[model samples]
Target: MTYFVKYLPVTTGNSTRLYTDGRDYCADLYEDLRSAKKFVFLTGLHFMAEFGLIRTGKPSDAVATLAQVLRQTGERGVQVFLLVNQFWRDESEVITGGHPIRAKIMKAGELYGYLPETLKLFDSLKGLKNVHCRTDIHPNSDIFATHHQKTVVIDDRVAFLGGIDLTYLDGDRWDTSEHTARHRHVDRTQKFWHDVHLRLQGPAVEFVRDNFLQRWNHGSLHTIRKKSLNSYEAWSQHIGEDPRHVAVEATQDRRPPALPPFAQKSVLSYTYPADGEEPAAPTVQIVRSMPRKDNWHRQKPTWNTNRSDEWEHSCKEAYLIGIRSANKYIYLENQWVADEDIWAELAAAARRNKNNPDFRIILMVPYEGLFAAGLGSNQELFIGTEMEDVIKASRSPATFGMYALHQHDRRSNVQGQIYIHSKVLIIDDAWSLIGSANAGGISLEGVRSGRDEPDTELSAIIHDKAFASAFRSKVWSEHLGVPVGPTYDVHDADRFRGLANKPGGKLRFFPGYDNIKRGVPTWFPESLQESRDPLRIDFAKQSRIIPSLSRDLLASGLPPTLVRAAFTARVVPSVPPGWRCWYRWHCQLHYDPTEPSGRDPRRAPVYLKLRSLKYDRDEVWNYSDQDSVYIGKLSAERINAETTTAVLGVIRCRVKILPLDEGPNDPGPSMVLQFECMFLNDRFARGNHPDFVRR
Candidate 1:
């Protein structure tokens, strides 16, 4: 299998360096596009026309940056195409419950008025004839599975890619000074956010350009010229190749790097575009994936069979190639760090001889979970537990370490806390991939997100020694807790010495008891088994009395509907499936090495019984308790005494109730009673139970 890679060069000695703040980058990009003579193709997840250039101010009066770009290029007879994720306006209506009935009616009227206004904006770009703008929607999933890849390719000679979007949010800056709420809300406060982006000029530009063309032409909606076509002009001129573009000599073709215990591929050389009108750069390959069909607007579907496999292959190949070839160290930054397989490989590499220690891997991730809020009950806990498992599985406890950097406030002398937004990997000193692809299956396989196409992403390989050396140095400085300056060197002993000298600066190990300077503690000083087990709880006893208590509340003049809804929703303190599994596993694994008896057999059944009960209960309690409450509240105030009695009778028939079962010896009954009481109390508090409220 052929793996694609490219080299990007950073312009040295220029303060015009790229920074993470979106506004600065956007301004620079806009200038670049305005000056372009050749082809211009741009793609991003979302691009609302409302937000414009500039930070902390009314959007620049540049009413038609995009439209102007099209017209100018068209007037120049240049081929200009723009591709955006086909966001279904109606889908939002369905997801958000039709966006408030009032808003829907108002929006319909506005659309009628806005259509003519939008047409006027379209007419302003009359000079540019060869322009086409369209939206590409993926079929596999909803609007959330968007074409997130952001790139701007001009004449296949220069390209830009990173988390920077074309929308308004992309232009905000970090602000450290305290400002009044009104001032901050009015966009006067200099609130900056951390982010990263790359400009590619070498062979990589071709890959990005190709990706944009493919997405634009394959989109569901195709824009046509309002008038007859005049002469067409090419967008860009082929300036000669940059002198720095080196020829890659073929080495003995090694087996494509494999998941470790197998040899890995090393980075040989990288090609990047040189800054300036200095000749064009070497060839860079660009690879992208998205849903096969454009579901953004209603259109015919485009199918690609190998897209999933190809997307997964890209990330795996990149890692394998980089890891095998890495001789010194690897640096990575991502929004999340939870990939078990890759962590395993790093652990293996770290376990090698202490002298060589394979390669040092450094990762920077966000301080808090990105999608933790959306996860159902216990999902966040499961993810956290799994991440720890990955860390422990590593060969050496110290093999991996994570950190977050806060951008400093120049005025307050207080550094803004670091928020990692860039997903980057730099292996050895030779290979680097910077793009929007997170370390997850959805980004890799395009499967879970209902995406028919792979994630729209862009990354370029960098080969320049100076660029790699500088970039790697910056990352290392952050990892080693060194100030960013010329004093640090990865190969120098002083670098390690400086780290050792800092207060509480000793190297920390994974799964081992140690104190860290920043971030939460991962390992405990003593065995974790001795501490209380949060998962341990009885389900059977809880199940028994819960139904009885719920029925009692209903019989006592509580709305039956409310009681039923609360019971079905299961929100009133009950063992969720994951909690049960965890509890069981903890008991089974909670072995005391000090005990003379080998692993306890009694502890083994704990997990088994838990699993069985969960499976069975799932059948009994699958309905929504919330729904029940909603319905019961609307019913007659008088309690349906007969129905309540029937509910209690059914509970008694289904569950074996015993007084002793309420104690520690029988955890199930106790849990059932606790759930039952809480359910009734909640109903009474809500005035859903007339008897309790009246009494």
Candidate 2:
């Protein structure tokens, strides 16, 4: 009943190079883009038109910018494609007066300049005939969902994917490896940024390329124009273009680019001790958090869809699996660690390591995030408290260390704290996972009704000793100011503890981190936090509701034991063919304790109701119309955990459908499925330590 599914297989014969900061990433990406011959693909939350692809003494020079490279590349008929995240909220939140969320939006805009930059970037590529541009909007954008993947595939032979976006909003994303803050500046004050990226080649590149094509072929150039951005309507409407059509039409006949022959290449951007053993090309597996529903039919296989394509959350699965599999030490460096499930797993790991004195769990994150006044800082404090509570509740003996990164001058004057934008996890110097997906609910949790959906994400897990060891050593050396020798053990937990305690480098104890016992702050309400940093949907409540339903069936002259079996015996209706459907839909099913069932004195019957729905790609529907379908109520039964057979009474299931019309090159009808059954793999219901769910 667990929702965890191993979606992607481990791919071998892949060469990888890791980048710690923006300067190296920019330099390497620039060189690769210049070498691109067949096609160039890029996707991200924000792709600024003025973002410099290469660092120069004069940042104002247009020659080093991405727009310039894309222009030149398109002119050479290289077929450049870009998919950037653009949302309706970005416009309404900024321009709409008296909007409910305008204050928060304005605060964000004040910190990071709010510009119609997605449009700006698209317009910059206007004159280039071969350069194609599109905007990827989340289906639930009205509820604040947005695309968050930062990835690039060049010529279908090489790929770069990670947390760093090609934008200069908060600061120049192209900072040096040193992360100096003394003189670096773009528009406002300089910010020290610490992030990680991966350059991959071999069979693994195919996954990244396919991901780009899937999104590009299905996404649009812009949302159908509504109010503002009159310039947007003028530009897109005048052309009357379908970007998906344009991209697919362009690449339909092109032969798949053959994977280049394997070569022994260095995967490190820095010189580090490798125990005198050449690291083999890593065996890499690509994982992602993709949306469940789209406007058109998809070709990729999803976890739940039998022959159909739908949502996939392999990225979250990979994180939980990697943490559970850690044997010696766990190293996590992410921009945000706000998800309770992730923190719960860390707590469980600590308890598992309680008997081993050498066991350590280390976390490195930003001292202060982009919006400190919002959920970011509050979540940091809440996480520290959660971890502290677990340590007490479980009485774990594992050495736990939480630290942040900052820059300082010779006189030890605080220059700036480095924004830890890296999403990295190294386990026992043998396994590593890196990508753009943060350790936050928005990036890891699956979709839910009346709640935010997970961000679309792309990441890779590498199972290579050499690669993981080199990465840990290189990063730990910079933070601890200690040079690693050829024989130094990266996995020795004691060595790290000693070095971290005597840190003279960037590593500092996280601000406001304490061992005091406290719940989430009264000031930072969980409801507000859920709106911003939401948690995973709880589907295990079916266990409680089903039993109540069974009691009601008993009062209606149905035998107690047979009541549970009857539900499963009645076959559930299958999703109809000719409809490309989402495996699950959003429905509101609440049990009101005050309103008891008339059949049973102690039980309450669950009622199903509809919420706001979208029937077409652009229109919102408040009530069901001709375009919608309401399948009759069905019974979903509980199963024995091990036997996988029905063992409990029926849980009433509701299926609500929002049907969408086919596109120009239609494969079939697109349907939104909202059904209630049971998700057995709910971790919270699996009897995890009570402190995990405790305040």
Q: Give the number of the best model, judged by lDDT.
A: 2
Residues 1-695, model 2: lDDT tens digits: 11123335446788999988887888888888888897888888787787787655575456868888777777777888787776443443323222222233334423222335555666677877677776666765543356879999997689999888887666567777566543345334334778899999987787787777667656544522223335654354332242211101111212332323323323232122232232355567788877666443462523123233356667877788778877577889987776666877888877787776666777888766434312211234235445564555343333666667767554424366677889999887777899988886457653343222567889988878888888888887767666754233534444443443232456555543422223311122222333321122222211111111222233444222221111110111222223222222223322223322111113443432211112222111222232222211122121112212111112232223222453223332222322223211123212211112222
lDDT of each: 0.39, 0.54
Residue 360 shift from truth in candidate 1, angstroms: 2.6
lDDT of 1 by residue, 204-238 (tens): 45456545544454444423222222233111111
lDDT of 1 at 326: 53
Query: lDDT of candidate 1?
Result: 0.39
Q: What is the lDDT of candidate 2?
A: 0.54
Off by over 4 Å in 2: 1-5, 58-61, 89-93, 100-106, 109-115, 186-190, 220-281, 294-310, 373-377, 393-398, 409-414, 446-452, 485-505, 515-695
